[model samples]
Target: MNLFLDSFWRSVAYCLRPRVIALSFLPLVLMVALALGLGYYFWEGALDWVRGALESSSMVNNVWTWLQSAGAGSLKMVLAPLIVIFAVTPVIVVLSLLMVAILMTPALTLLVAERRFPQLERKRGGSMLMSLMWSLGSTGLALIAIVISVPLWLVPPLILVLPPLIWGWLTYRVMAFDALAEHASVEERREIFRRHRGWLLGIGVFCGYLGAAPSLIWASGALFAAAFVILVPLAIWIYTLVFALSSLWFAHYCLAALQALRTEKELAATTALAAALAPSQTTIDVQALPLPDDTTSDARPQS
Candidate 1:
């Protein structure tokens, strides 16, 4: 618990640093540009397709008719845009996470290491290719979980719970691995995961909830289209900052854990060596030896 809170506060403090703050914008700029470019190309077509799909559905038409009778017909205008926004929101989130992992995590890890754990060895347990593959694989599973759990999300409470849980699991997997990739060997990394899985996941889930905050801006964008162009970059920037904080949290936590693990193993090794040499260091009783020299000398003189 101390470790968890310690790392969390450290990460929060680090986020305030000029260097860390600047590093966060790198992903933000790239994501914002990519988001704008995609929005330019596909925004209209996606809205149209969603509107057409809604129009083609008899059930949706019935709901629209009922809504009209209920004097809530204005909802019909926003529904397509809302659908498009929701659909694209997940992609934005995943991309934001990946961007942090790819662009910001290494630097953040190094920043933490250099400042706090300067003596920690770099085992280079995970390479860029391995980290990429691990991230992609975890992301694939997370997307699958999201799709499978979408129905459950209709439950009001589950909606809040499930998405964060998925994002949290993904964050834990990706952030923790990247944080330790350069400093911990494969064995040490796995050991830390084994020992601290619960706390790490908690950090990820907490960050996941933090990541969800930007969705409010997304929602606002959908409702107020005029502000979308501005809000989207804002939301993307928030996502980048949130994930950057997450990367720092994991880096601090995992590196500290690695240092502790090595210290523990070294202590145990020293203890074991001392135990092995202990008997040899015991005092011997020279007086307890049999005295055969006098008898032998007397016998030789008599002969």
Candidate 2:
């Protein structure tokens, strides 16, 4: 609990740093450009496809006709675009997180190490290639979980529980590994993971819930079509900021945990060495104590 709260406040403070704020924009810009490029080329085609799909469903078409007759035809105009946005929101989120993990995490970890754990040794437990592969694998699994859980989403309680859990697992897996990659050896990293897995996943799940806040903004973007150009970037920026905070949180917690691990090991070693020497020192003390010399005991012998 102390570790969790310590890292949490530290992360919140770090997010306010000028460097951190500047770094966040990189992902936002990349996502915005990607969004714009795709919108320019495929926007119409995607909307048409969604509309066609909606139209082909007799039940939906009947509902649409009723809505039109009820003088709510304006909803039809936004529905297709809204569907497209909803369809793409998950992709955007996954991409934004990946971008932050790839670009921001290492730098944030370095920053935390420099400021807080400067003496922490760099053991390079994880390499760039390995980190990338791990992230991709985790992401694949999370997506699969999302797909497999779609039916379960129809259940009211499960809908609230499952996706965040999957995302939380992914967030913990990726962010914690990247945070400790440089300074902790593989064994040390594994030990830290084994010990702090619950706290780390708590942080991830909390951040996962935070990550959902942007979807509300995304919904607003769909509702107010005129503001979507602005809202899309805003939503992406929020995602970037949330991921950035998550990275910082992981960095602070993992590095601190690693430092504590080293300190504990060092203390244990010192204690072991002291114990090993105590017996020899006691023997020396016993030997150094002068034995009763024969000459000194002459009076006792005569007695």
Candidate 3:
């Protein structure tokens, strides 16, 4: 909890840094703004196109006939391409953003880590792919649970535990691992998550399932698809923000874990130097840390 809270703040501070913030989020905010622009353009087009199709068709002659004859499957057949276009485009945009976010994380850690453990990355831990996979896969599961539970409005709230817990574990790894895995890449991270397919699925089944929302994000988590108007457009933006910040928070944990696992000399050196290099105690965080998982490790960094 302590670790996550710090990591969360670190991400915000790192993002807002006079120099780093300008360097990092300038690209990010611009990209987001551009993507949003493109998204709104296309989304409106898709809506217009769908409405035009429905209006042109005799489907609405009688709502029941339209429903019984042209059911969702039938409508999907007609709108499939549009659905694919609208759906896949946003996904691509979000993935692009994640790529950027992952790249930005190391920059935030570089200054602090260098002043503390100059020889970072000699420590033990999963490979880059392995570590990133842990975080990505966990988040992915959270998404899946949310997607799968769209029909069960009454049950979604009960499935909300998965994301937070899985996310917390991933946060611990990200905060702790980066100090040891400087050479890690985004591709490696994705592959690692792929390698641990079962764990990711298990996370969803066990905990991520709790994150399932009967309602999509923008629609106020509404239980029914009837709320599509509010959910569709805004979900992309809202979910992206939540997921991105959450991923950064997790990354902070693994990065911190990387530092924490160092030796006592490293710890002493860090304790002293951290005051100068560190973002203040309030700046450093442990809330994002995993619940002292024996499933992981706790050795401090070496000087």
Candidate 4:
């Protein structure tokens, strides 16, 4: 519990560091460039498709007619763009997350290690290839969960519960693995996961909620398209910063757990060695003791 809170605050503080803040923008820049380029090429096409689909759908047309009858006709103008925005928002989010994982996690992990655990050994348990594979696999599972859970998202409460939970699970798997990849061996990493699974997942879920904050900007962009040019970059930056903080939190907690695990193993080994040598040392002490007085006196002088 102490470790959990400590790492959380440490990560928050680290996020404020000039270096970490700078690192956060690296991903933001890349993501924003990617977003702008994609938007440039496909934004109009996507909007057109969404508008056509809405217009062609009888059910949607009925809804729009009903809305018009109810004096909410202005919503019709907003619906197609809203659909496009919502549809593309998920992709943008996933891409931003991947960008941070690929670009920022390793650097952030290194920063945390150098600052807090300078003496921690680098076991390189997970290589770059392995980290990428792990992240992709976890992301794939999370996406599957998201797709399967989409229906449930219509439930007001579950909508709040499900997405963050999936994101949290993915975040936990990816960030924890990356944080420990360099400093903890496979066994140590597994042990840390086994021991601290709850706390780690909690951290991930908390960050998952933090990650959701950017969605407000997305929503704002959906409502007021004029500000979207400004909001898109801002949303992407927030996502990057949130993920960066998550990387740092996992790095701190996992590395500390690894250190504690190693210390425990070392202490246990020392104790076993002491136990193993105790009888021998007792025998040596007994052998070195002066002869018993009666036996020695009788043998030496016969009184």
Candidates, ranked, lDDT: 1, 2, 4, 3
Ranking 3 against 4 by TM-score, winner: 4
Question: Considering every candidate listed, which one attains the maximal lDDT?
Answer: 1
List, residue by residue over 163-278, the lDDT tens digit for candidate 1. 99999999999999999999899999999999999999999999999999999999899899899999999999999999999999999999999999999999999999999877
What value does the lDDT take at residue 105 in candidate 1?
Answer: 97
- In candidate 3, residue 239 scores what lDDT? 35
Q: What value does the lDDT take at residue 6 in candidate 2?
A: 95
Better of 1 and 4 by lDDT: 1
Runs of candidate 2 with Cα error greater than 4 angstroms are 59-77, 295-303
lDDT by residue (29-71, candidate 2, tens digit) is: 8999999999899989998999999989999889888998999
Backbone clash count, each prediction separately: 0, 0, 46, 0
Give candidates' CA RMSD values in order. 3.2, 2.4, 18.7, 2.4
Model 3 TM-score, all chains together: 0.42
Write the number of the candidate with greater lDDT, choosing between 3 and 4: 4
Q: Show model 1 residue runs off by greater than 4 Å.
A: 283-303
Which runs in model 3 stand beyond 4 Å of their true positions?
1-15, 26-30, 33-37, 49-97, 119-143, 153-180, 183-252, 264-303
lDDT of 4 by residue, 217-292 (tens): 8888878989999999999999888888899999889988888899999999999999999999999999999876
Model 3 lowest lDDT segment of ten: 206-215
Worst 10 residues of 2 by lDDT: 294-303
